[model samples]
Target: MDRPLGPVPAHAALEALLPPTALLVPEPAPPWTAGWDERDENDGFRPDWLQVRRLVRELMPTPKSVTRERMAEAEKECGALGLDGLDGGEGDFATLWTTRTGAWLAEEIFEGLTRLCDVMDLEPRLRDFAEEYVRRGMTVEAARAFMLAQ
Candidate 1:
């Protein structure tokens, strides 16, 4: 008769699927870090800047309060004034939001990227370099490539 699969067999399967250097169980948390738990308790309350950017981009194709024709007309007038497109306006919106809210989206993104770098034991200088690249009108893909090269 075939043996029934049990907890031991399941655990063995999980172990085999993981990296060879992986621990079977999590390590115990340090007592000294216990107080740091509350530090991130309010993390959920922070706005997701990535999602905000996406929403703003989507709204760009459609005027928020104006009619489509009026938006097109306004775009033509803005172009006559040397403006590129609604994207330029969205950039201004991002700047305004960051200034008003006391939280810059790019700074938050940089912080998250640096934290990930820390976890991977990689150099943190990429964050500042990326900021400079973006400031110089480099695309995000270009910035990422520059960072990865570092």
Candidate 2:
């Protein structure tokens, strides 16, 4: 009765905060064994980076992400056509996609994706999704299939 209150272990506190099914899942192997290294650089930048981004986002359920992605793509395409004449031009999109700079930007953005982000940069939802995957007994192999099936 005289024992003073004790601090909970950090892990215990985290576990308490998580859903009963929460888990710690490992990252899936990048789908393409070699990665998207051989992007077609001649034509207007293909925006292949968007493909990588899509891959990562779909792996996790961030909700509302689909709409945002659609919107971003629409905006970029619109800009490329210079329909708005404010942000993008066909040439602008072409330059961004077909050059080293564009690839670099795509690589950077792919890493910035919440699911694919560096551990230190992950948002709470992305981190939670990783944990939940483990909790749900998703193995790296299963994750690969899961991603492919989607």
Candidate 3:
């Protein structure tokens, strides 16, 4: 349901500055774009550091030449991701990926499933059958069969 903004007045100015042959396609606005009209002075949500870095990195080839306009676009994208409520902390994709795979055993998997349920506000159940199947080092399909038998 989200849509990016279309070309703006500044884009026209930018196009004029460039060579006539050079293509000047305006970048798409962030998904949850908001206006700064007087009636709604609040610009809208702000993305966290991680989200900003990711968006910018995805758009630009290198981080050295980031412009104010590009930064604004990244911020808007972050808002779309529901990052406004997050505490201001500088984290990147590396941090998230590094922390996600500390455990691989059955106990760890069981614990992770429990945590997932908590986050989703779902009722937790003791998945003993699944745990036993995992402990035996069976393939996922076989484990599922064992679980069904229990």
Per lDDT, the best of the predicted structures is: 1
Give per-residue CA lDDT, model 3, range 1-150, as digits (tens): 022212232123222222222112211112333432222235544334335445556864342344556555655666788664123544443322112111112223333433444344322123443443344332234334433433
- Candidate 3 contains a number of clashing pairs equal to 0
Query: Which of candidates 2 and 3 is the stronger one according to lDDT?
Result: 3
What candidate 3 gets wrong by more than 4 Å, as runs, is 1-48, 89-150
- The positional error of residue 98 in candidate 2, measured at the CA in angstroms, is 26
**In candidate 1, what are the lDDT values of residues 63-134, reduced to their tens digit?**
233344444554455556554433333554333322312122222333445345434544444445564534
Could you tell me the TM-score of candidate 1?
Answer: 0.21
What's the number of clashes in each of the models? 0, 4, 0
Q: Sorted by TM-score, highest first, which candidate order results?
A: 3, 1, 2
Relative to the unseen true structure, what is the C-alpha lDDT of residue 68 in candidate 3, on a scale of 0 to 100?
57
Candidate 2 overall lDDT versus native: 0.34
* Best-first order by lDDT: 1, 3, 2
Lowest summed lDDT across 10 adjacent residues in model 2 is found at 1-10
Give the C-alpha miss distance for residue 78 in model 1, angstroms.
13
Model 2, 1-150: lDDT tens digits are: 112111223223223323344223222222343334453435343344445344434432332233445445644655464444112224333222222222222222222332333233333443343344445443334333323322
Of 1 and 2, the candidate ahead on lDDT is 1
